[model samples]
Target: MEKNAAELLKKYLSGQCTPEEKAMVEDWYLQLPFQKKAPAAEQIEASHDEVLDRLKQRPKTRGIGYLKHIAVAASILLCVGLGFVLFNRKIEPMAGLAKKKLEDVLPGGNKATLTLADGSVVDLDKALNGEITKQNGIVIRKTENGQLEYIIQDDPDAVSGTNTIATPRGGQYQVSLPDGTKVWLNAASSLTYSYPFAKNERAVALQGEAYFEVAKDKQRPFKVRANQQIVEVLGTHFNVNAYSDEPMQKTTLLEGAVKVVAGGNEVRLKPDEQAKFNAASTELVVDKNIDPDQYIAWKNEVFAFNNEDLKSVMRQISRWYDIDVAYKGKITTEKYFGEIPRSANLAEVFKILELNHVHVQVSGKTMTITGN
Candidate 1:
């Protein structure tokens, strides 16, 4: 037990630690009970003399077990200070929150709309899990797993036509292109591609965010155009986030290679690299040693935030939960780092935020951040 560690724990208990310090203290404290080697009493005495003296006054029968009980009590106090109540070994809303009975919004799921070449719209959510439509020799079907797939049949008379698949707010969808490329569209995103890819190129226009597993075709390169930026690759696994509301467009490579071009500026990316394109400055910058999982976590049914700002986190929440967000007064500048399951209901997600001292008021489809 170092002096610094004791000080950090004290700050965390009193809710006076910084965001980074809070995260560190919580992580360490949660694992303290299960640590293989507990610190010696002498170490505690050296760091926190008052705590050791208080422990010594207790009965000998309550030795290490008494310390464990103290740890549990401290944890409970920490939880309460952070607006959480421990119930049956689970974290739940405080009594005040429970009494409010806030309206719970369900999480997003497989939902999208498919626009045919003829401008006909098909709601994928209501469409049957079978042949959705047949255009020329291309057979579009909705799989049982809620994936929209295209099967190309050999037809000499087949002609290429443009088709678009879009996911509305609180929705997401997966699609397999005519060229066998797999795409996972995030909430409020769209992907437009040719029914039968042109002979010399396979191109798609993307809006919002999508993760792509491009099919290999040496003769025809795969290109994704998003927010005035283009990502070109023969075959690669990558993710692109080009939401209009976001400050910058991001392209992260997971495998193979990709060349991101924007405003006549270009940068080639290797695996584990991310290219950030700023539309305002028309500058394309590459970040090395990036973690691709964080960018693609949404596709895997999780919301991963790595030192993200509160506004950015709320934007993702608004899109996925189909809600509008507004802020009042000054908000905390603390950066958040964690993951929340996409399956969690709105109330559950807000509870997590409350644990971080973010106060939110939910009214129908809108959420207002009152304070922190």
Candidate 2:
């Protein structure tokens, strides 16, 4: 029975489990108590023993079926606990993983820079909350909650110029545009727009990634230009990821409708649909019925990966942690699926990755990944 349990666990790890078996293993894992912090070295073995004993005491029923499942569950818990300990020991030789805590990299926060029409820059991180500046009948204020807000004043004679807001690596920011549109910029992203907007339309240019809640104005359509693609909408909620490092630019719509135009091709996206544009091919593709929440998870302070590839996952980590990633060996093709808080330190995030056979070594502002 023990040998059978071990075999089942091995199969589960190697992605060979049948649907029912996979569900069973995952259910058992999810039922385990969540640990707020890593367990001490002394508690490791004792905790393992207690959990194993509890699983073993379950009454036998329906021949080998009941006992077989209990044994498998015990093995899964044992393997996970042991893997955590072994990974810590292999990564660093320190007293009970204490050294790892000290070397951890903290997560990102609200940090950005605002560039006025005259090209003067203000570091939002250092600037005091309240009226940041006024230009051409527009009042720029940094709110108490650290958000940037624009208040438009009546000045028909004023000529509005372009203003830009940018966030550096390991940073993010929220801004309310002059037209009442709210945008949340992710790390290493920028948004540029004219204050007071144009008389005919409301338009903005984006780089990197941002989530937008457009203000309703039937006469003036809102458009976002990124990566040679333009997303046009009347009033909608959507997200755009147009990082130059990425293979494709994606525009995801959460509500209302949007049309993505690129390279003489256009695709209209309904709610919960995503339009992907690849610059290399100059082709646009539309995917329907995707969960919009996963794309905007970062805005909500969470890292959500839905069967995402390793390189893509690392790209997100690199931007948010302000680290450079290099591969030592052939990258694994394994797809990762999970949600980790954006607030977790680098070490905690790496620990989760290590469990899935993706190892990371941190040095200064760089991270090296080696696949098992």
Candidate 3:
């Protein structure tokens, strides 16, 4: 590859490239010669050495695996890289993250508490798979696959009741709204909606993070109230991150269209676009260049961080692991670029951090971080 192309890839990895530049670099990456079949063990080592040697020719950076070009290339080469490693070595790609038996923290699953308008709470995790309850002529059932779904009866006399489903730390859940919209909540998140959606509009209150695959209803626009922003869409797939600890609330659209309103401003977002709302200002900035997969990866049971900072990564870890994080030194400024399965234990997560010069010490459920 030409030096210019490498430089462009570096920019793309760091999330500094424009939409046009990102597309160009992605095209160039696809054109690279990748192995079609799994190579022998000897060929595996040779390819690894070749990749390492090429990486060594690049400028060194502060953090390990934090090399700008290398990390960028690694993400693009993930399919080819992991396929080779798995087919040849028959080992986990991230062999470094050994299971931490002593302090193993499993990933979050379909766990949440559903609160009815009458103030009755149902533990979705323990509740048997079937009709859990009935409110306002809406039948709430726990599906065999561990999903909470609502079936609205055709009774015109059906009442409307607001219900809330909350996922605790180290827990997550999925629910189908009465309007047939599917929502997947992440750990430490909640979604509140009326059992029978209003005839005029469909609205839901949200906290933390959630992914939505809204059912098409052009007559009544679907609106989500998350933090200080409101996302309105007719029918679309989107992900919203409104965690209180996060610096900014992000609304990323994956399909169709949506209008995000924050403060006194409103911006329309297209597919693959994201709207960021800062707490300090009312200005809603719409970023045309974005990767929706990184935002919704949590719903898919993976932790995907693209040019994410150490503190940001830890926030997700702390919530998912249900652990506390304390900083021993000024290391939150470090940036990481990679993906890891959320199923990994706490110790395994720490191992990945260590590779990036982040030293983590876990005691019980508390984790302390220090600079390397």
- Compose the digit string of candidate 2's lDDT tens values, residues 310-338: 78888999999888888886777755455
TM agreement with the true structure for every prediction: 0.76, 0.76, 0.76
The per-residue C-alpha lDDT of model 1 at residue 358 equals: 55
Worst 10 residues of 2 by lDDT: 82-91
Candidate 3, residues 284-332: lDDT per residue as tens digits? 8998766677788899887876656778888999899888888886574
Identify the runs in model 3 with alpha carbons over 4 angstroms from their true place.
1-102
Q: In order, what lDDT does every prediction score? A: 0.76, 0.75, 0.73
For model 1, how many clashes?
0
Which numbered prediction scores highest in lDDT against the true structure? 1
Pairs that collide in candidate 3 are: none
- Say which prediction, candidate 1 or candidate 3, comes out ahead on lDDT: 1
Q: Which residue pairs clash in candidate 2?
A: none
